[model samples]
Target chain A: GAGVSQSPRYKVAKRGQDVALRCDPISGHVSLFWYQQALGQGPEFLTYFQNEAQLDKSGLPSDRFFAERPEGSVSTLKIQRTQQEDSAVYLCASKLKAPGQGRNEQYFGPGTRLTVT
Target chain B: AQSVSQHNHHVILSEAASLELGCNYSYGGTVNLFWYVQYPGQHLQLLLKYFSGDPLVKGIKGFEAEFIKSKFSFNLRKPSVQWSDTAEYFCAVIRRHSGGGADGLTFGKGTHLIIQP
Candidate 1:
């Protein structure tokens, strides 16, 4: 089966430009998450979705970050204005269902490397 | 806020050498611990998890980790490593959400392991 996948394996943008990153979760996964990984560092949580509802956005850094999953399967993380600090690998992960159901493993995508110059 | 720590930023070893990677987290509440691995050009994959029951958890490809509450550690170990084991390893933690839904994970800086043949 196809796992979670992100679009545009690599993206380069000017510092003030806006960018939208897409994620396609596993076919039946109900939980999806986004993370950011800086060079030589680990990934940091960004946001989470349970179906179409944006359950958690606490991890989002600022107002510049917005995410939506209108159809409950495909998601998009939009940055209003790209910043040099935003240059990193953006990762997407999906799980089969809600947690505490005796199964809670997230499958990750190859991630999209975003570079803001 | 919860935070994960991976002491070793990089480790180099020869094939067949024993391997141990240190991981520690700080959170006063109950949490789920996880280990993820990313090979070159590949997405992050689950190595193992420790949710409940036995403290010692085993993962895929001859890997195991021990969760020690007292030390706040979950170090990964392999009796003998292969060159194929060379990759970046991450330690993550998820705080048990009271809402009965999934939560975002806090990850460490990650450890880059290089194995020579």
Candidate 2:
């Protein structure tokens, strides 16, 4: 793909249900990022991956949020026991270079808007 | 942890009006700054970026930003705005060397800009 692509443009889930969001990064992109954006707010970092390694998960808000990029190409973010507070847009981005290496812009995908009822 | 702050929650301007959006960060060390815009029904797109050497950097669509190291601010500017420019803008920063969790970006609350014609 020419750009990052995410699955499920919108999702409606009941409270306590589990939801999974998928992201397919551009080919050859070495870095992938996940972010959460609540209404009226900017996207906040949720986790980061360099290749298949989960280099940074410090930004994940809770233990229920889990992200994995198993093969360095596609990634999945799963939220267990969803809550109303979890309602937000989940964004996926990919970069061509490693962190701290040089200047590379992160290209974002059309995020999945999740609504927990 | 690094944090970003965007002062303007909402802004409105007429066509051809000059525009400026303010952004500040909490980290004191070396950082990379970026401005991203999200149009309605569209994905987030990079507007501009500032990394090293030059404090002023220009991006597509007549957007520019200045990185002020002394004040830890990266402010976005445009000489004129059109109705098509009405969108949400975000300021983001990446810590250069945090050792463990450096890859993910810290973003501000964003500014919702409405360029009225």
- What lDDT tens digits, residue by residue, belong to model 1 across residues A49-117? 989999888888999999999999999999988999999999999988866665578899999999999
Clashes of each: 0, 0
lDDT of 2 by residue, B4-107 (tens): 99999999999999999999999987788999999999999999998898899999999999999999999999999989999999999985335744686778
Q: What is each model's TM-score for chain A?
A: 0.97, 0.98
Error of 2 at A15 (Å): 0.8
Q: How many backbone clashes does candidate 2 have?
A: 0
**Which candidate ranks first by lDDT, i.e. highest?**
2
lDDT of 1 by residue, B71-104 (tens): 9999999999999999999999984455654577
Stretches of candidate 1 off by over 4 Å are B96-102
The TM-scores, one per candidate, come to 0.96, 0.96
iRMSD of prediction 2: 0.7
Which window of ten consecutive residues has the lowest lDDT sum in model 2 chain B?
Answer: B95-104
